[model samples]
Target: MNTQYTDSKIRRFTIFKRLLNYEHLSYQQLSEEYFVSRSSIANDISYIKKQFAKEDLSLTFDNSGTFFNGNEIQVQKLMKRVILQREEVMDIDNLLMNQIANVFHEAIEKREIDIPESHIENIVLSIYLIIFRSKQGYTIKLDGKNQLGRLFFEFDKYPIVYDLLKEVEKCGIYHFSTDEAQHLTYLIVGSGLRFFLKDEKIPFSFRDRIAILIQKVSEGLRVNLTQDNRLEEDLVVHLYQLFLRTDAQTTIVNPLISEIKQTYPSLFGVVWFALSDFCKPYQINLSDDEVGFVAIHFQAAVERLKKKNKILFVCPNGIGTSSYVSAKIRRILPDINSIETVSTSKLKSMDLSDVDFIISTVMISEQRKPVVTISPMVTSKDMKKIMNYYIDLIIYNEQKITEKFEFSYETRELIGKDIIFGNFSTKKDALDYLFKRQDFSDELLKEDFISSVWEREKLQSTYFDNGFAVPHGNPAFVEKTAISILILDKAIPWGNQMVDVIVLLLIREEDVEKVEPVMNLIMQGIEDKEWFISKMMEVRE
Candidate 1:
C-alpha cells in the first residue's frame, strides 16, 4: 500500500487548509490555489474518502451542502497540527504565519497563563493558525460533542481571550466566530503545562477525582496504588489537558503509541481497563492514542517504583568538581538509591562488594566492578552513556519476566566455536547468509527459523548496543539447541541500534535454562565492544 498518510497533502498544508474550511471549494479553485491539477485534487479527495469509512469520518459533496459530515472541531484540531508543522518550510507564507504566531506569544506573556515555556509557543502557534483560518473566510464551527469540559465559557474569561485576538484583528482580517475564541481559550487554559508551571500542590477537587480514578484503576488492574503520589499527580495533570483537547476535538497523534504498547503491554492493558468505562461524562470511548498517552505517566511511575541501585562515584579530581559530578548524577538519575563520593585512595582501602557501579573522572587501569569513565562536568553524550548503563542494570535486575527474557553470565555451555565472522549490510542478508551455514535438525525447517527471527525483531529489536543483536525465534521452532554468531563487516542498522555482531541463539524449549548464560556474556561482550571485536577477529583468522 503506497498510502502517503491518509491526510496527505498535494501541497504542504494547502490541501487541508481548503478542504477543512466551512466553505466548499471547487476542484478548479483548489488546483489553482495549490498549483496542482484538478485531477490531482480529485485523487486527493478519493484517497481521503477511502479512509473516512474506516476512520469513522464522513464527507458529503452534494446539494445537501458540501462539507465533511463529521466532527468539524476534530478537523480543526487536525488543521492546527498541520499548519504548525509547516514552520519547517522556508516560504513567504510560512514567514507570515510565524509572525502571526508572535502576536499570540506576546499576549500569553502578558496574561501569564501558567503554562510551561515549552508549550506556550505551541499554543501560540495553534491560536495563530486558528485566526489565519478564520480570516481566510472560514467560520470555525462547533460540530462535535463537547466531551472535554461541560463549562464552555464565562464572560470574564472570554473577554481576555478577545483582547488576545485584538492584535490579529487590527490588521483588517476577517471577523472570526465567537466559537473560535472559546476554542482558543480552552486550548490555552487546558494545556498540561498549566499544572507544572504554577504550584507543586494540585487542587483538591481535581486531586480527589484523580484519587478515585486511581482507585477505580486499581480495582481494574487489581493492583493497590492508593497512595502513589507521583502516579496521582501525573494523572491529574494529564487528564486536565486531555479534557480540553477532547472538548475541542483536538487530535493528538502520539508517535510512541506502538512502541509504548509493545514495551509496556501489561501497563497499557491496565490503563485501557481503567479508562474504558471511567471517562463516560466525556461522551466518547477513549482512543488508543489517548490511552497510550496516559500509559506513559503510569510507565514513569512504575520505573520510579523500581529498587534504586547504589552508585559510588570515584573521581580522582579534587572534591570541588567531584561533588559537582555527584550532584549532576543525582539530579539526572533520581531513581538512584544513593550516591557515594570516594577518593581513589579511599576506593583502594574500601570494599566494593556493596557497590552497584563505579564512576570515575580519571581512568583507574585496575579497579572493581563496571567502571564508567566520565568527565567531571558531564556532557550530553556522557549522560547518554550513564543513562544506558543505569537502565541496563535496572532491566537486568528485573528477573520476574524470566520466560520472556532469560540470560546467563556463566559461559560454560552457551558460546564457543559457534562464533563466525562475516561481511554484510542488511539484517535479512546477514541472517540469511549466516543461518544457511548452520546445520539444523531434520525436523527444523530453515524458513521457519528465519521467519521466527523476523517476528521477534518486529516485537522488539533484539539489538543491545555497541554493535550486537541477539535475534532468536520461539523455542517451538527449534529442534536442537545450538548457537551461531555472525560478525558483520560493518555495523548494520537494527531498529535504533546499529549492529556488527549477530548472536543467533537456537535454544530448544528444553535447553533454555542451560543456554540462558550466553545472554550475559553476549551483553558483556557488547559493552566492552573494542576488546570483544579484537578477540573475535583473532578467531576469524
Candidate 2:
C-alpha cells in the first residue's frame, strides 16, 4: 500500500504501473506512503488520468481506490509502455529478461517458428512480463468478448508459444495459469511476425482478401499478379497475421520503411492506396511500416512480371550444328534465360506459345512470335543483329505496358499543365504553389482536400532519399485526377531530405488504377534528377 520513489515523476509512473497491475491505491494510502500531502497524491492521480486519456483509457476510482478501467488488451499495452520506458521496473539487472530470452530462443528454434528478427525482442519481453505478473498473482481475467480465447484457440494453433512459456516457467520457478498461458499466446500472435505455418491452414477469408488485394494492385500496374502463386502465398501468410495483430492492437516496426518507400515508390503508393480500401471495412488504419511490408510483396510480383526472354532455337541444319549454334548464342547473350534447340521439322509441331521469340539459323517464312535470323556460325554481324532485336523486343514489351495508361512519363501530358518552376524556401511554399495551380482548381478548393494532404503528410513525410518528395492527399477527397509538379530552382528542406522537385498526386476514387504508372513516372524522375528536370524544362519550352 505504501511505496517510496525518488521523485514525483517516478511516483506517478509507479502508481500507473500499479494500476496496470490491477491495484486500487487510495489517496490516503499513497500520500501516507510517500510522506506527502493528500493533494500531492491527487495531483499525481490527475496527471496519470491525463496520460490514460491520451490512449483513450480511463483511470477510475470507487470505494476501493483508483485503478485502470479498460479491457485486458489496453491494460497490457499501457503496462508494456510503462515498463519499456523504465525497463528497470521489470528487472533491475535484466538478468531475468536475458534468461527468458534465451529460453524463448531455444523453444523458438526447436519449434521452427519463423519469427522476424525485429519481433523477437518484443516477444521475449512480453513473455517475461506475463511470467513476472503471474508470479505476483496478477493473473489475466478475460471476459466473454475477449477475442484472445477465440483468435488464438489457447495455443493449440501455436504450440511453440505454449512451449516457450513452459520453458520460461522452468527457468523462472513460476507457474502460469490457463489465463496466463492464453495471454502469453495472445502477445506472440499479436506481433504480426508469424510466417510459414506449415501445420496450419490459411483461412479462406484471408486467401480471398489477398486475392482481391492482388487483383487491385494488378489493375493498377496493368499486369496480372494473380497468376504468381508465390505472391498470393506470401500475402496470405502476411495479411492473415496482420489481421490478427490488428485485432490484438499490436504494432510491428519495419526499420526499412524509408528505404522501401524510396526504392519501390511506385509499388509502395499502389499498395498504400489499395490497402486503404482493403482496411476500411475493418477500420484498421495500417501504419506505413505495414504498408511497406505489403509493398515489398507487390514489388516482387513486378519483378516476376518482367520475365526473362525464352528463346526457341530453330536450325534447318543437322543436330550437331543446331547444338553448336544454341551453345554459341547462350555464351553470347546472357539475357536469354533459356535456349531450346529444335529441328525445323519439329518446330512446326513444337509449342511456340511458351517461347517468347524464335532464334533461327535459317529464315522462317511465317512467325507466331518475333523471329531473329542469325548465321549458323553465329557471326559477328549476326550477333549485332540478334542483340538489336533483343533490345527492341524488351522495349516493345515496356511500350505495351505503358500503352495501358493514356499518358507516359516521357510526354508532357501527365504533368504538362501543372508543372511549376520556382525557388521555394519551404515545403509549404512549394506545396502551396502546386495546390493553387489551374490544373487542381476544381479539386484542391475543397477544405477536405487540403486537410487530407496535410493529415497524410503528418502521418509520414513523403520525402524520398533520392532528393525529392511525392506528397499526396487522401484519394477520397480527390474527384478529378492530376499530377502536379513543382520543380524548385534551389533545394529546400522537406522532412529529412533536401528536395529540388515535388510530385504531388491528386488521384480520384475511380481512377485509383492509375496510381502505379503515375508513381512510376515520379520515381523515374527521382532516380534521374538531371533527366527529369531536363524533360520538364523541355515541356515548359
Candidate 3:
C-alpha cells in the first residue's frame, strides 16, 4: 500500500472526527487516538491551522485545551472537500484496474506470454471475483494458480505474487511483483461488483470487466496502496493511458431516463441533446431523461471546473422559469448555449466562472459572487429591467455568449424592498387587501392581480409540488399595483393541487416581459424538500 496516501487519509479522518467530537482537542490527544507520535500530530495540526487562518479562522490553545474558532460554515466546507477528495481517490483506483486489464489483454494478444485462452480467462475471472469481494469488505479465498496446471510449477515459488494479491484486495491496488514474474497485475473492482457484493450476491457473468476494474481500483487506492506501492514510472504512465482510454469507451445506462421523460419531456429532450454532445468524445450513451439529469450534472461539473464567479437563482418548479430563462438568454444572446437551471445541490458544486450575475429572491451570500438578487414575487417590469440590463451588457460587449460576459460591477442593485408582508385566510381576502391597497381602483387591481394570473396560467400553472403556488398576471395588465402574499389556513385548489401559499405578483406592462429570472428564483428556493417546507411555514401577516 502507498504509505504516504494511507497516512494522509488517516490524518484527515482523525482531524475531522476529533473536531466533530471535541470542540477543543490537543495535538497530543490526537496522537494518542491515532497511535501517532506528537511531532507528526503537531505537523498535521499546523497544516490545518494554516488552512483555517486563510479563511479568517483562528486556531488557538488555551489553558483548557486546543480548539478551532473558525467559521462553522467554512469548517464544514473544508470537511466536505476533504471527504470528496477521498472519494476521488476511489475513482483513480478504478482507473488503475482498467489499465491492468488492458495490459494483460494486450500482452496475451501480442503473444508476449505463452498462456492458454482458458487460463487467461480464469485469471481474469479470479481477479474479478477477488476485487468484487474486497470492495464489499468481504474475506476472499482464491484457488492457487498452480492448480490450473497452465504453467509448470517452479521449484522456488515467489511469495510476492500472493502478497501482492492480498495487498491488492486490501488496498485496491499493489505494485509489488516477484522476481520470477515479468509483469504486474493492476486489479480493480467496478461499481457493478461493489453493488453485488454490497447485496451479498455474486456476478453470474464475466462481461462486466469495467465494473470490476472500477471497484478494485477504488478499493486499492482508498486503502492507500497507490502511494506506498510505487510502480516503475513507465508502467504508471501506461496504466494511466489505458485506464483513460477504457473509461472513455465505457457506457452506463441511465435508469432514471424513463421517469424523467414521463414527468418532464421537454427538459428531457434538452438534457438528452446537451449530454449527447458533451459525451461524444467519451462515447457514453445517455438516455433522454438521463441526458437531462446529466445536463444538471454537467452544469455542476462545469461549475466545479471553472471555480469562480458564483451565481445563484431561485424559481418556482414547473412554472416555465427554467424554460423562460433559457429562452431569454437565447433570444438576447443567441450563442450563449451553456446556460442551465440546476438544483441547489448541483449549484453547490458549480465552478462559478460564468456566474458573474445572479437573479434570485433568496438570501445567498453576496460576498462570494457578484449578484443581482431579486424577490421571487418580482414584478414583470422588474424582470424586464433586469433581463434587459444583462442583455444589453451582452450585446454592448459583443459577447454573443453568456460565458464571454463578465460582471463589470461589484454588485447589482436590489429591487422592490418597499413591499410589505401580509397574510390572508382566503384568496378573496388576499385579493381584497391587494385591491384596497390600490385605493379601490377596480381597473388597476383586475389588470394587475386578476388578469396577469389568468394569462400566465394559460401557459402553465405556477403550482409546483408540495402545496405551493406563485400566482401572477402580466405587467401590461396593470395600471398600478402592490404585491401581496397569502397563506391559506387550508389548502385551496389551484391548477392541479391544493396550494397553501400564494405569492401575488404585480408588474407594469411596459417593463420587459421575462419570467425566467423569477422562475429561476422559485426553483432555486424549493429544490430541496427541507428548505421548501421551511419557506412554506414562514409566518404571514
lDDT of 2 by residue, 406-522 (tens): 346534565677778879899888887777763444554556788877876665566643667778777777767878788888889765346787888887767767777666666
Candidate 3, residue 491: lDDT: 66
**lDDT on C-alpha atoms for all candidate structures:** 0.63, 0.71, 0.41
Best by TM-score: 2
Count of residue pairs whose backbone atoms collide, per candidate: 2, 0, 48
Task: Find the candidate with the highest lDDT and give its number.
Answer: 2
C-alpha displacement of 498 in model 2, angstroms? 9.2
Sort the candidates on lDDT, descending order. 2, 1, 3
Score every model by TM-score. 0.51, 0.53, 0.24
Worst 10 residues of 3 by lDDT: 405-414
Model 1 lDDT on a 0 to 1 scale: 0.63
**Residue 338 displacement in candidate 2 (angstroms):** 5.6
Candidate 2's error at 330, in angstroms?
9.8
Tens digits of per-residue lDDT, candidate 3, 346-412, equal 6567777666565654555543555555545456665676677666655644333222112122101
Residue 353's lDDT within candidate 1 is 82
Task: Determine which window of 10 residues in candidate 2 has minimal summed lDDT.
Answer: 402-411
